[model samples]
Target: MDTPLSVLFSSAEDEKYVLDCMAYFMILMAACTFVCLLFKDASYGRYSSSKYGFLVNAKLAWFVQELPAFLLPVCLLIWASSAKSSLLANQLLIAMYMCHYTQRSLIYPFLIRGGKPTPFLPFFLAVVFCTYNGYMQIRYLSHYADYPADWVTNPCFIAALSWFVAGSALWLLGWLINLHSDHILRNLRGPGESGYKIPRGGMFEYVSAANYFGEITEWAGFAVAGQSVHSAAFAIFTAVVLSSRAFSHHKWYLAKFEDYPKTRKALIPFLV
Candidate 1:
C-alpha cells in the first residue's frame, strides 16, 4: 500500500504533468493561430470571406464561449483544497481573473449592439480554450500554488504587489477603452443605415484597432499581476492573435478607404 508521503508525491507529480500538458497545448494553439494568419485573417468582422459551416447569434456566442472560463474556475476554487498553505494571494489572483470573465461572458455580451453573427467553428474553439485555460489557471492557483506566510512582507511580494496594482489599473483602463471603442463601432450605423465607417474619437482617433490594443493591454497587465507561467502563456497568446487581427483590420480599412487616416497605426498608439 502506498504511504501518505507516496500519495503526496504522486499528487505533486500529477500536477506537474497537467501543467506540462497545458503548456504544450498553449504552444500548439499559438502555432496554429500564427499559421492560419499567414493564409487568411480570422473569419470574423470584416474578414469573414467564405461562409462558415454554422452560425450563431454574436451575443449568444460570446456569452456561451466565455462562460466556461468564468464558471469552471469558480467551480475549481470551490472544490479544490489549497496545497497545505494559506492561499490569500492565490484567491486574490483568482478574483482578478474572475472579474474580467464575469464582465465578458455575463455582462458585455448582453450589452452588444448590432453584433454580427459568429461562426460555430470559432465559437466552439473559444469554448474549448476557455475550459482548458480556466481549469489550468484555477487549478494551479487553488490547489498547487503556495506563498510564504510572510510573503506580503517580502521584497518580492512588495514588488509584485506594485505590479499587481499597476496591472489592475491598466486592465481597468483597457476595459474602458475597449468598451468605448466598441460603443463607437456599434453606433456607426443606426436604423437601416448599413456599412462600416472610419471610427473616430477616443483611441479610435489614433489606432485602427483600438479594441484589440485594449485587450492586449489588459492581458499584459494580467500577466504582470499573476506572474505565473499560465498567465504569461495567456498574455502571449492574446498578443499574437490580436496583433494579427489588428493588422488585418488595418489593412482592410486602408483598402476600403482611399482617405483613411495616414497617421493611424494598426494596434499601437503612434508606432506599430
Candidate 2:
C-alpha cells in the first residue's frame, strides 16, 4: 500500500475498495471529458488556444506532465511490501508500464521539432492524470495484484503461449508502431517549412490518426496482460480520450486539406 494513504485503508479489503473507487472516478471523468470535447477540442498542440490559460513550451510540458508516471512507480516498488514487490511477474508488469512512459516523458519530448506550445490547463490536467494513473497501476501491481505461477512460463500451446504471452507481444507491436508513426509525422515537413503537410507512408496511408491508434493498442495490450480492473479502466479511459482527439485531428485534416483522401478514415482504417 502507498504509505501516505496508509491511514485511509486499514486492511486489504479497504485498499481494494479505495482503488475501485478511484477507477470509477476515472471513468466518470472520462464521461465528462468526452462530452466536453464533443463541443470543443482540447487546448493543446495544433488546437492550442489562449483561452485555456498561458501556454508552456511543448517539450517542457510533455516532460513535466509525464514525469510522474515514471517516477511514482519506482517509489511504489521501493515502498511496497516485500511480498508483493518481489514477484517476477509484478516486476515484468511494472517494466512494461515503464517502457512506454520512459519513452514518452524522457525520449519523445526531445525528439519533437517546431512543436507548438501547450496550454497550461491541459498540461496541468496531464500531470494529474499521470499521477493518478501511475499510482493506480503501480500500487495495484506492487501490493495488490496476483498471478498464476504458470502465467509467465506456461507451455501448453504454441511453444510458449499458454500464458499471457500474446498480450506482451501486442504491447511490443504497439510500441513499435507508435515510434514509426511519430517518425512519419516528424518528417512530414521539410527544413524551414512551418505548415502542416499530409503524412504519408506507414499506417498514415490508411488512417489520419495513426499515432493515436498505436497508443491505444499499447494500453489495450497492457490491460490484457495485467488482467485487472485497474488496467481495464485505464485502457478504456485512454480509448475515450484519444479517440476524441483522433476525431478532432481527422476533422481538422478534412477541413485543411482540400485534396485529403476522401477514402481515408479518422482513427480506424475503414470502419471509423
Candidate 3:
C-alpha cells in the first residue's frame, strides 16, 4: 500500500504537497543539525582521516556534491510547466540561487589548491542535500509560487524588495570576502610546502574562520530576502554547520600555533 507521503512525492501533480514535504524535511534537518553539533563531521582539512573509509579528491568531491544544485534547477525549469507571466522578482531570486551554486559547483572547486581528500560519507551526504534543496527552491519559485499582480507597486512588496536588495548586497560582499580569504589560504603554501599558516589580512585579522563567516552571512541574507520557510531553513542550517566548523577550526588553530593572535574570534568578528 502506498503511504500518503510516498504517494504525494511520487506524483508530479501534487506540487503543494511536495513543497510542504520539503518544508517539513527542512524542519527535521534543523533538528538533526542541532544533534549533529555534538559531533563534528569527520572530513575536510585536518579532520580528514581514513576512519570513514574510502576517499575522493577534494575537488572531485566538491564538484560532484554541488553539481545537483546547479543542474537540477535547470532541468526542472526545462521540463516543468511554469506559471504564465511569472513575477519578475521570482525569476531574479531563482537566478540568484543558480548564480551561487554555479560558482560553488563549477568555479570554487577548480580554484581549490591541494585540498585534503574528502571521506565518502560526508561527500555523499552533501550530494543528497544539494539535490533535495535545489529541487525545493527551484520548483517552488519557478512553478508553484505566485505573487499578486500589483506586487511591484504594493508597499509590502516594496519593503520586501528592499529587504532583498539589502540582503543581496550583504551576500555579494560576503562572497567576495570568502573568495579572497580562500585565495589567501590557498597561497599559504608554496609548490612543495604543505602546512597550516596563520591567515593574516582582511577579515582573518579579526576572525579565525573568515570564509565561514562570509558564507554564513551570504545565506542568512538570502533567507532574509527570500522570506520563505525554505530559505529560512537553509540559512539556519548554514549557520549551525558553519558556526560549528568555525569553532573547531578556532580550537585547532589555538592548539597548533603558539603565536596565533589572541584577540581573534571564531566566526564573528568580535562577538563570538
- In the range 41-122, model 1's lDDT, one tens digit per residue, is 7786555433764777888988999999999876666655555325556666677678889988899888777667887777
Cα TM-score per model: 0.87, 0.92, 0.90
lDDT for each residue of candidate 3 in 73-140, tens digit (9 for 90 to 100): 87877766656226776776787788889899989899888888998888888899899999888877
Model 2, position 3, has a per-residue lDDT of: 69
- In angstroms, the error of model 1 at 119 is 1.9
- Which stretches in model 2 have alpha-carbon errors above 4 Å? 155-163
Cα lDDT computed for each candidate against the true fold:
0.78, 0.84, 0.80
**Model 1 local distance difference test score:** 0.78
Measured over all alpha carbons after superposition, the RMSD of each candidate to the real structure, in angstroms, is: 4.0, 2.3, 3.7
Which pairs clash (backbone N, Cα, C closer than 3 Å) in model 1? none
